[model samples]
Target: MASVFNAVDSISAELATIIQLEAPDEISVTKKDAKIEELMVMDQSLLQCMGVSHASIESILRTTLKYKLAFKLTGARGGGSVLTLLQTLLSATVVDKVTAELESCGFHCLTATIGGQGVQVCFGGSS
Candidate 1:
C-alpha cells in the first residue's frame, strides 16, 4: 500500500486537464411571478377544491409547463393546442371513443394522415 501510494504521487502532473471545481450560477427565472399569476387565474377555484399543497405543486412546474394532480384529481385543463398523431399498423374500434373523449374536453380532431403516416389530431378551442 505504501509503494502504491508513492507511485501514484510520483506520476507526472502534466495532464490535459486537472480536477475542476466550480460554483455554478443560480438557476432562476425573473418572470415567474407573472406565470404563477396566470396559473392561479386558470384554475384557482379547482385547485382550492382539490386541497393540493403548494409545495408539491410548485415542484412540478417550470417556466413552460405545469402538470399537477393531487388526491386522484387532475386539474381543470389537461392538454393544450397541439397535433397528436397515432400511427397504428392495424385498425381498431376503441380509437373512436378516444377521439370522442378528446372532443368532449374541447379538441378539434382534424385530418387523419392515413397509411403512409400517422393519424394527426389537431386540438383547439376558444375555451
Candidate 2:
C-alpha cells in the first residue's frame, strides 16, 4: 500500500509538471498546496464512480490552483468565480477545452446563472 501511494504521488507530480508546462503564460503554476476549500469543492464519490484515480484528482487540484491565481490576476470583482474569470480572459475554444479536460477527469461542466449573470461554468458531478 505504501509503495502504491508513493507511485501515485510520483505520477501526480509528473502530471503537475506537464500541466505547468502547458499552462498559459499569464498563469503561473506553483508547488504551493491548494487550499482546503478548493480541494473540498470536488465531488469525491462522483470522481470515484467515473474511475478518476487519486493522481488525476491531484492534477485537477493543481490546475485549480492555477485557475484561482489567474482569476485574481485578471482583477475579478466581488468574488467572481474562476470559471467566470476564465470565460472573460480566455477564448471560447480555450474555455471549452478546459471544460472538456475536466469532463475527461470525471467532472461535469454546467452552464448556470449566478448573481443574475446569464451564463457561468459550474464544475461538479460526472458526465
Candidate 3:
C-alpha cells in the first residue's frame, strides 16, 4: 500500500513540476502525460534493484522481445513479476518459446497462485 501511495505521490509531484514549467494549454496536458510515461520507465529501472532474481527475470524479458514491460509489486503481500504489455502483436508461441529458452538458461519460473500455506503458528506462551 505504501509503495502504491509512493508511486502515485511521485507521479503527482512530477506532473506538478511539468505543469509549472509550461503555460496552461493543450501542450501542457501533453507534457504532463509524457512525464507520467517517464515516471513509469523510472519505476522499471528501480525494479532492477529489487534483488538478483527479479533483475534476472527482467533481463530475460528485455533480451527475448521488444515489449513495454513493467515490474510491479502486486498483492497485499507485496509480490509480483514483470508485467508485459505488447507494443506489437505477438504469437502465443513466441511467448512459450521465450519461456522455454529462459528455463533452458536456468531461470526458474512459476505461475501465480493464491491462498497458499502461511507460516505455522505455535501458540504456547512466549519465552
Q: What TM-score do all the candidates reach, one by one?
A: 0.25, 0.30, 0.35
Off by over 4 Å in 1: 1-80, 114-127
Q: Determine which window of 10 residues in candidate 2 has minimal summed lDDT.
A: 71-80
For residues 37-99, write the lDDT of model 2, one tens digit per residue: 232233232334445445644565566555552211111243212332242234566667667
lDDT per residue (tens digit) for residues 93-112 in model 3 = 66676667767878655544
Q: Over all chains combined, what TM-score does candidate 2 have?
A: 0.30
Best by lDDT: 3
The Cα local distance difference test for each model comes to 0.34, 0.42, 0.52
Instruction: Choose the strongest candidate by TM-score.
Output: 3
Regions of model 3 farther than 4 Å from truth: 1-40, 48-58, 65-81, 85-89, 111-127
Better of 1 and 3 by lDDT: 3
**Residue-by-residue lDDT tens digits, candidate 1, 1-127:** 5654343333212111111212133222213323333333334334434454354333222211321211111333562223232322213444565456546655455535422435566679533
Model 3, poorest ten-residue lDDT window?
Answer: 67-76
Selected candidate, larger TM-score, 1 vs 2: 2
